[model samples]
Target chain A: MTAESERRTEIMDAVERLLARGGVNAVTMRAVAAEADVSLRLVQYYGSTKDQLLGATLDRLADKSVERWQARTRRQRECASPRDIVESFFDEALPTDRESRGFHRVGVSLEGLAITDPDVAGRAYQKHLKELADHLTGLLQSDDRSAPAARLLAWEVMGLAHGLGTLLMTGQLSEPEARTLITNYLERLGPQLCL
Target chain B: MTAESERRTEIMDAVERLLARGGVNAVTMRAVAAEADVSLRLVQYYGSTKDQLLGATLDRLADKSVERWQARTRRQRECASPRDIVESFFDEALPTDRESRGFHRVGVSLEGLAITDPDVAGRAYQKHLKELADHLTGLLQSDDRSAPAARLLAWEVMGLAHGLGTLLMTGQLSEPEARTLITNYLERLGPQLCL
Candidate 1:
C-alpha cells in the first residue's frame, strides 16, 4: 500500500484501540494522534472531523468483520449442516479469548455510542447490524427452513450472542457456564434444525 | 413521606431524566440542579458527588425494576407456568412504549457507564444484574428444571431481552418483528417448559 493509505490505516487502528479501551468518549482527535503516534496535523489531514473519522472507522470495521466471517464460512465444506454453522457461530462469536474480547469491547462501545449518539454513530452501527444480519440470514437459510424462519432465527442468535457475550464480558457468567447455556439452547433448537 | 426524603427522590428523578435523555455525560452537577429545578447547593446536599448520586440512582432503579416485576408476578395466579413467566418477561422487557423506552435508555446508559467506568459505576451495574438474575432464577426454577438449568435459562432470557431490546431501540427491528421473534423462541422453549 502507498504511504498515505498506510497512515490512514494506522489512524483507524488507533481509533479502534481508543474505542475499545475507553469507549467513544475517549476517542478525541488529540488522543487519536497520540495513539497513532502521528502528529495532530496528520490526523486532521487524514480525517477533518472526529465524526468523519469515527464514521470511516466504523465503516471499515463493519467491512472487516463481515469479510472475516464470510471468509471463515467459505473455508468450510459445502455440506456443513445448519447445526454445524450455528455451533461454529457460537464458538466464533463468544468473547472468551483476548482477541474476541477486544472485538466485543469495540462492539459494546459502538452499541453504546449508537444509542446515545444517533446522529454521528447510529447510522454506521445500523449498517453494521444490517450487513451482519443479511449475511447470517443468507447462510442460515436452507431448503427445509423457510427464509422468514431463517431470518428470525438469525436475529435470535445474534441477540443471544450479543447479550450472552456481554454477560461473559462483565464476569456475570463463566466460560464453562456460558458453553452449557449455549448447549441447552442448541438442544432446544435441535428440532428446528431437523438434526 | 418526609420532606427531606421527598427532596431526595425528586433529585434522583431528575438524574434519571438526564440519563435517559442524554446519557451519563449529561448528568453534571449544574445540569442535575437545573433539571431538578433546585439550587446547585441543594443538589450537592442531596448527594455530595456525581458518582455518589449516580450510585444511589442505580440502586433505586434496581430496586424499583425488581419490585415492579415481583408485583406483576404476585398478581398472576399461583398456577402460572414457567412459560407464562417467560412470556410475561418479554412483554414487560420490550421497549415498545414510551415508559419502557425511557427505562431501556437509562439501562443502556448505565450499561455503557458500567463497562467503561468500572471504577465508579461498574460495581453498581453488576449488582443490578446479579439481583435481577437471582430474582428471575427464583421464579424460573421448578422440580423438573434443575437449579443450574434455571440459572442458565435466566441468564439466557436476560441476555436475549437486553440484546433484542437494543435492536429494537436502534430501530433495526420493528415492534412486530421483535414480537414475532419472541413468539418463535417461546414455541421452541415450549417443550422445555413441560406444559
Candidate 2:
C-alpha cells in the first residue's frame, strides 16, 4: 500500500477502536488523532469532515467484515447442508468473541446512523447489509433450498443474529442463554431447510 | 406532577426529539438545550448529565410505548387472537411512522450505548428490553401456547421486527416487500401459536 493509504488505514483503525470503546460518541477528530498518534491537522486533512471520515470508515469496515467472513468459510472444504450453513452463519454473526462484539457495536452504531441520517454513511450501511445478505444467501443456496427461499432465510437469520447480539450485549440474555436460544432456532429451522 | 417533575419531563421530551432526529451524537448538552428551548444550565439542572438525560428519556419512551400498546388492545377487545396481537405488535414496532421511526432510532442508538457504557442510560435499556419481553410474553400467554414457547416465539418475532425495521428504514426493503415478508412469517408461525 502507498504511504498515504497506510496512514489512512491506521487512522480508520483508530476510529474503530474509539467506536468500540464508546460508540459513535467517542469518535471525535481529536480522539482519532490522539489514538492514531497523528497530528490533529492530519486527521482533518485526510477526513475533511466528520461525515466524510465516517462514510469512508464505514465502507472500509464493511469490506473488512465481509472479508473476515469469507476468510473463515473459504478454507473449509466440507459440503455442508443448507441447514448447517445457516447454523454456521449464526455462529459467525454472534458476539462470541471480543472482536466480534466490537463488530456488532459498529453495526448497531451504523444502524443508528442509517435511521437518523440521510447521508453517505447511511448508504454505506445499506451497502453492508446488501452485501452481507448476498454472501449468506450464496452459502445457503443448494439443491434443497430455492434461491428465493435462501434469500428470505438469509435475511431472517441475519436479523435474528443481529437482534440476538443486541440482547446478549444488553444483558437481557446471558451468554449461555443466547447460545441456547440460537441452538433452538437452528433446530426449529433445520427441518424446513433440509426439506 | 410537581413543578420539578414537569421540568424533568420537558427535558426528557427534548432529548427524545434530538435523538430521534440525529441519534446519540445529536443529544449533546448544547443541542439538548437548543432542542428543549431551555438554557444549558437548566438542561443540566434537570438531567444533571448526558447519561441522566438519556436514561430518563429511555424510561419515558418505554412507558409511552407500552401505554400505546395497551390502549390499542383495550379498545379492540375482539382482536385478542394471537394472529391479531402479533400483527399489531409488528405494525406498532416497525418504523413506519415519523414518530415510530424516531423511536427506532433511539433504540438503535441505545443499543450501541448499552454495549460499552454501564451508565444509568445503559441500565434503562436493559430495563426496556425486560419490560418489552414481559409485555410480549403477556400477550402470548394463553392455552394456545405454553409460557416458555410463547416467550421464545415472542423473542423471535421481536427480533425479526427489529431487523426488518432497520431494513425498511435503510431502503433495503420496501413497504410492500415488508408486508409480504411479515405475511409469510406470520403464516408459518400462526399454526404453532393457535389451537
lDDT of each: 0.84, 0.81
Can you list the residue pairs that collide in candidate 2? Answer: none
Misplaced by over 4 Å in model 2 are A1-5, A41-46, A75-77, A141-149, B1-9, B38-42, B76-79, B142-147
What's model 1's lDDT at A68? Answer: 71
For candidate 1, the per-residue lDDT at A19 reads: 82
Query: What DockQ does predicted model 2 obtain?
Result: 0.61
Model 2 lDDT per residue over B26-113, tens place: 8899998887788999998887889988998999999999889877877776857888888888888988889998998888888777
| Residue A34 lDDT in candidate 1 | 98
Candidate 2, CAPRI quality class derived from DockQ: medium
The lowest-lDDT stretch of 10 consecutive residues in candidate 1 chain A is A112-121
Q: What's the lDDT for residue A5 in model 1? A: 96
Kindly list the per-residue Cα lDDT of model 1 for residues B114-185, writing each as its tens digit.
Answer: 766684556788898998899889888888877888999999999999889988988888899999999999
In TM-score terms, which candidate is top?
A: 1
Pairs in steric clash, model 1:
none
For model 1 chain B, the run of ten residues with the poorest summed lDDT: B113-122
Q: Model 1 off-target regions past 4 Å? A: none
